[model samples]
Target: MNRSSSSRAGLALIGVTSLVLAATGAPASAAPALTMTLSSTTGPGGGATIVGSVTANSVTPVPFPAGTNPTVQFQYVGTTAASSACSASAKVVSPIVVSNLLTTAGTLTVNPAAVKRISTTKIVFQVPSSPYPVNDANGNPSTVNPNGLVLMGGQTSSRWSVCVYDSDNVTTSTLLATATYTLAIKPTITSILPASSPAGGGQTITVNGTGFAATSVATTATAGGVALTNVKVAANGNSFTATTGPRAAGDGLPVVVNAPGGTVSSLDPDNNSQTNDPPIPFSYTNGISITPNQAAAGTQVTIDVIGAGFSSLTFDAGAAPIGSGAHVFLVKDAYVANSNRGVAECTGVSVIRDTELICTLDLAADQLNPANSATMPGVAIAEGAYVLTVVADGGTGAGGSANPTIVSSGATFTVGPY
Candidate 1:
């Protein structure tokens, strides 16, 4: 071959190499970058409508042509795994699964049709109230492509990411751009209805709050030290109802509520002050009744009063069991006389078990009487229809001090004149 002919051939080879280099872009060129912005970062877990946009930093480097449409997807990822059969790892997270969200018939990928494109850089999307990932063709959790990364409601501080792909074939396509996001909402309790309940408890209470879960197993409510039962959350996941357990009469009994998204308590570390509005208040049952409604004055009479919220002091088995420091009185009007107060009918206030209080109504005509004067003076009264009342703590006669600890409504009775 002549030297001139060889040189021409080499120039032809160089021209062909230049053409190939021009067609396949250089490797150093940067991949397209994406910026994602959300309308809001926090909302109740049941379902929140999230509006956002993914803007490409450089349109030239995008995988698709300028006018070509691209696909986008949203996922709640606990932690990333190489395959769908995921195991626990710091970088990988278990999907937040609501009941029936990922059943045998479903898949984990959100609906591609739900993504609405307004322009090249803008799009709008709505997350369903629950049952996320509009489609999971095979509810089987074992595979890695779609359902494996789904997150359910009630999980707090979950991490979410928006992945842009060339097409809806997420199984085979590589992600063009991914933007990580956070769904941060703690469980909170705004109010509890029927704040005050009977001392015996067992009252249905309504709890209003944000991020309440319909799944009762994922939520909890308690009053005092007793656990609440029959808990049911509203469909919107904003409120719930539960029956309270037995609690003694008192003020400032803490109420605690815990949900999958967050936890709130009357005795929270942020604010420990307790009020009836937040905590559980137990009022006296006020259903006292006497064995005999009528009795003769100045005669020894034993009365049985049955009601609730009567204090019973626990004593050592060997030690003398002191009666509950309760005082009974016979007055013209329970409401009016209760304000004035009176001495107890008998000093020995014996509590039979926890419900019944037995006391000797020693209605002696005169104070000079010494019968049954073991501890207190026999009750001296005139014949008339009177109301019987029991007061805990120290009792005073006629303009006496009120016992702030415990008080009961009066029982109607007739004292026959002798």
Candidate 2:
């Protein structure tokens, strides 16, 4: 039975082999043949260049072999010292572009190797793939790196290589040309906003400037002798908004704006279009007083008062003790005080017409303390060497003066005991 099975298997093999030989009209042991060559290469910037050529040799063109994609690539491997092969490996910096071929010559492929730095004058590049048959107008395959192919900052150099490939899965690349070139870096800033505001603050305050990047802006201000609140900066680093308590009625309560760059002061330009030029300064005048200077304690003493330097002709006593319900005086004193302070009441005691009293007053206060008390009862009797101390209310009887207190001896007053 085993001998019979072996004879049957031999007959089947003979029949299959006869069919294969009849179909191809040739022996099954015949080997298929293929060939490929390298073409050309080019660089993007102005650095180095490579040229490749490829050709494929095969009996049949119909059903060509498999992979065939030709490309050219460039890389910067830096300079080299004398004897040794350039220290570094070549990096493919540009994308591969397929070369358009005119004729189908078998199959071919090209692959670029590392750049070879020979010296300042000469450099070598390797075409690791097969060679092809293709020529440029100059009878040589020309290679070029486009002018604006920027790898890092500016542009690529003219020195580079191009790769060529055929349909037979073969490749070849070569150094085509060389060029000299360069690269550059770009500029930038970091913040701007108000640094401060007033406590009893008003709207219409503006805070904006330029040159801000990653940092934050800060705003600050003093309100009613206290620090302001709700200081905020916008996310874009462009502007800032803040609300502060009412301002104390004096100069130098600054609304400071700060960033990493520097600090700037802000002012209310809404009321009268005032320019906040630094060191030039701005002011609000607290009115001054004199006359009927002697008033009995607890009596409603009405002294004439006059004011200047006010845009609206109104005074805001920031921290002054004088209340809103007090009466105003009608008198102007231009003979004393500078324009900024503009002659308000002074601190300490003084004499007036036939009276002596204690005078320690701050005109910036909102209301007088002790109610209607301006003098001590029965404190002194003097025919001479008596001084008068008068306080000004923003009312009819309050007299306005540049400087309220008379500094000269002729302005002295004496008071007799009640």
Full-model lDDT for every candidate: 0.52, 0.30
How many pairs of residues collide in each model? 12, 134
Q: For model 1, how many clashes?
A: 12
**What's the TM-score of each model vs. the native?**
0.42, 0.21
lDDT of 2 at 207: 48
TM-score quality measure for candidate 2: 0.21
Model 1 vs. true fold: TM: 0.42
Worst 10 residues of 2 by lDDT: 180-189
Using TM-score, give the best candidate's number: 1
Candidate 2, overall lDDT? 0.30
What local lDDT score does residue 385 receive in model 2, on the 0 to 100 scale? 33
